[model samples]
Target: MSVLQRVVKPTTHKGKKILLKKEPQLIEGPKKTIFFKGRKTSDKIRHVLKDMYDLKKPDGVMLTKRNDITIFEDVTPVENFCRKHESSLFVMGSHSKKRPNNIVIGRTFNYALLDMIELNVEAYEGLKAFESSKILLGVKPCLVFNGPLWEESDELKHLKSIFIDFFHRESVNAVRLQGIEHSISFNAMPDGRICLRSYKIALKKSGCRIPRVELEEIGPRIDFTLRRTKLPTPELMKDACTKPKELRVTKKKNISTDNLGSTHGRIHMGKQNINSIQTRKMKGLKKTAQERKIERTAKRKALTESNELIKKKKVHDD
Candidate 1:
């Protein structure tokens, strides 16, 4: 009798939210972020980071600091952590005896490091709070850069630093830029301040409906608000020069200059030593004087024998 029963509806209500049975669509924007700190990382710094990013406690983004973690340790844990939590971006911090203050920021794709930037602690007073920008790529992406390899400006260096690899080989040109998926820009400021910006290239049509390629800033404008700290003695910085005792003095024991070691001052002298590149160079002085003398004598003997044969032939003919 009730083949078509009426669905329940609340009074004075528009409608109940419908839930899709399918898995959620992949996040197109900057979706997830994870933070991993070393065991030795300061609590104050962690607190500051939590406040700055407004991260929630027990979000699974804050990872437990494992012991035996070093600055030069393998990044497999980071890759695994991100993969486990489905995080796209991660900030790794470590305060080591090797590198006093260093932090590495990186992004991942399918558990592989897409890009990373390491900031060395030049000077740090105290960090109370910091600000970070949320960047996102448009639907499409393309890469763009300028300058040659050797004489590339500092700004170009900073721009190229964030990108793991853009160009296929060494050289990049307009011909090799086909099917490029990301847009990279290396131009910085006029005062030599490095401010790299990445863009996503998209096509937008005007009134005529003709598609025009456009670029929009995506993510990663890593600008650290420098916090002033009290550095150690300025006297520590001094001009390095070779002292009198630093010069290699010839000793009279049995060793000569040549027997001392490699000419390139290499401690480990072996066949595979890279300092032996000079041996591959072109040799200037070829044949020795004694070798030239012997060659001349041999040539003269051959010529004299030929002359004697010719004289005999003339005599026979006569």
Candidate 2:
């Protein structure tokens, strides 16, 4: 009898969960420092920070503690943090004695800020999933505040409508809000680091209404009217070419020879006229006979010449 050994292989059961461990990579904070400066002291800054934190609430706000702010350090990190958390709304609050209370509301993508101003909820929901899902991509909204309070004006209503239409179209996602000290002066900051200062708010509103008049119809209408006018036809052209000019006739009276009682002059004229008529008739008859005689002579000469040439040739041959 041979001894047989049986071995069991471990098998994974269906629906069993497997755990995988991922190693964490340490990332260093920005080497540069960021400082938030305003005309007011840091006490006002702290107050503004608190207000912003309260407004943002549950999402929790990320603030740079450094005294100096840089493009690579402060702005970049805030943008990155917003993207990592998939934050839909961003509020920027700055306190300065020159411009006491100011807030900026905006939206962002993972890569670039949209050029237009947008509301918070609308901006986030409107972002394209494929673009926003990328790593390390940051975007911000264009700032909308300048001059006066944006919410108070008719221009605000128009601008809001335009923004809503644009957002529904998913055309843009970033904006910035700025604060200015003067009532007439304001600043608008967009994501591209561009700023418009002391811009007139009324001017922006004046352009809001869509132009009602249509320019496209003008060209076709003019063309149609022009086509209706009568063009010159061939008949009209022929008539113009063949029309006769007017003739002006002037009548003149001459002294009569009969009134002078000259019988000799009259008799002389009658004889001359009779003689001229007879001469013309005789010349016509003479010309016809001469022409016939010339034709007969030419025929006779041609026959005699041909006979002589023939005889000469025969004699030479002999």
Candidate 3:
């Protein structure tokens, strides 16, 4: 006879417990990104990465040392780095004769690479090129995607989502009018290149209820041509997109909104006896025993009089 041995994992170590145990948070922290360069990089790629890092601000990690890793071939190093830093997003800059001025943007789920898109930086500009007041660090910028191609293909849709996620700093319930400081817009042209434009928002007095809005172009204008993409599997995509129960908006039954912004609801109820229902006890609404008796007596007298009239009418007819 042989006895089977079961291996049990240990949880007594302090460091292990601290590393493994994740406390549930009511509002999770903003997603952090890892910005790094590949073995070979160009001036344009470095500037792009630096500018993007500046945009990401306090929630981003910038690694100055070059890492020898290919994004499409082996993502193991990237995954390890992400796991170590607890980051969910990454942008890698690389340059080579084969693929010059290449930039890759990707996001992770469970510290694993979920999806990534590679783009060739066809044209580039930096912030120093424009003479305008830069947006404050940590201020969220409004993102705009102006192109029908964004909706035409799954790849374009994924790219749009990636861009939104990358630039979007934090989740906010409401934004004040004064908080609108900057905006980033992406325009996909028919030539299969995307134009990324940054602008500073200016609000002036309109002499009315609303303020007049104007956009001034800031620098760091980039034109990208999409090259390679690694999309997530359907199951992985679904799992990544799934929201927690607390975050989901539970639909209220029989509740609807009208065109005028009025909320309406339909209440279903069983048959109700109004007479048996208890109402407020008040002297004006209540009746004494004598009053109830008098009412009953009047009702009986009226019924008897009606019967007598009917009998007299029958006799007259006869």
Go through the candidates in order and give the C-alpha RMSD of each one to the true structure.
Answer: 22.9, 36.8, 5.3
TM-score of 2: 0.23
lDDT of 1: 0.47
- lDDT tens digits, residues 1-318, model 2? 995857433356432322111111132111111123322334434444453343223434455443232222235554564555545334443444443433333333332232113121101111122232211112122224453434554434334433332222113334322211111111222331212211111112335564232111100000000000112245543543342334323333442345656533222233356545645456555557777799889999999999999999999999
lDDT of 3 by residue, 1-318 (tens): 995958556577985676455433456667889999999999999999998888888989999899999889999999988988888899999999999999999999887899999999999989988898888889889999998999998888999999988887767888999999999999999999999999999999999989999999886899999999999999999998888888887879999889987999999999999989877487777888998999999999999999999999999999
Indicate which candidate wins on lDDT. 3
Backbone clash numbers for all candidates listed: 6, 18, 0
Model 1 poorest ten-residue lDDT run: 225-234
The predicted structure with the larger lDDT, 1 or 3, is: 3
Kindly give the stretch of ten consecutive residues in candidate 3 with the minimal lDDT sum: 18-27
Best prediction by TM-score: 3
Off by over 4 Å in 1: 1-27, 55-60, 64-67, 71-73, 122-318
The C-alpha stretches of model 3 lying farther than 4 A from their native spots are: 1-26, 256-263, 270-318
